[model samples]
Target: MCAYAGNQRLAGVRPRRPGPPPPLDPDAPIPDDPGPLLPDDPDDLPPAPHEPSPYTEPAPETPETEPEPV
Candidate 1:
């Protein structure tokens, strides 16, 4: 009755330290066709739903034509 609550018969034999269970490299190259997880059936599909380019007008600062005065 004096071993820090861990002397109860050594807790039913606890000692497992085994290794070596990982070795399988048989040429590994299996990937002939793994595409399309889930996305391609919107019925006739033509409206994509991105709508953000009504002509995209936001870059009109042109004023660099001072190189022809040489």
Candidate 2:
């Protein structure tokens, strides 16, 4: 079996460390509530055009076939 390049590391090699987070602003304005974008009243909305769904109606029953004699 062959060894990967990442598996072989030099004796004194240390992993890099992450820096500290930046300070926040105290005087920033509080976010306002984003209200419903759609109209509250149902009458305001346009009526949906009707289209018959294929799956809405039950499939037609198939006639039973007579069994074959042995």
Clash totals for all candidate models = 0, 0
57 Cα displacement, candidate 1 (Å): 40
Question: lDDT tens digits, residues 1-70, model 1?
Answer: 4334664654455556789888978998887897876658965345445744445655558965766765
Which portions of model 1 show Cα errors greater than 4 Å? 1-12, 28-32, 43-70
Question: What TM-score against the true fold does each predicted structure earn?
Answer: 0.27, 0.33
What Cα-based lDDT does every candidate model obtain? 0.61, 0.69
Which residue pairs clash within candidate 1?
Answer: none
Tens-digit lDDT track of model 2 for 1-70:
2333467855666666888877878998889989898899976766565744444774468966879999
- Compute the lDDT for candidate 2: 0.69
TM-score of 1: 0.27
lDDT of 1 at 70: 56
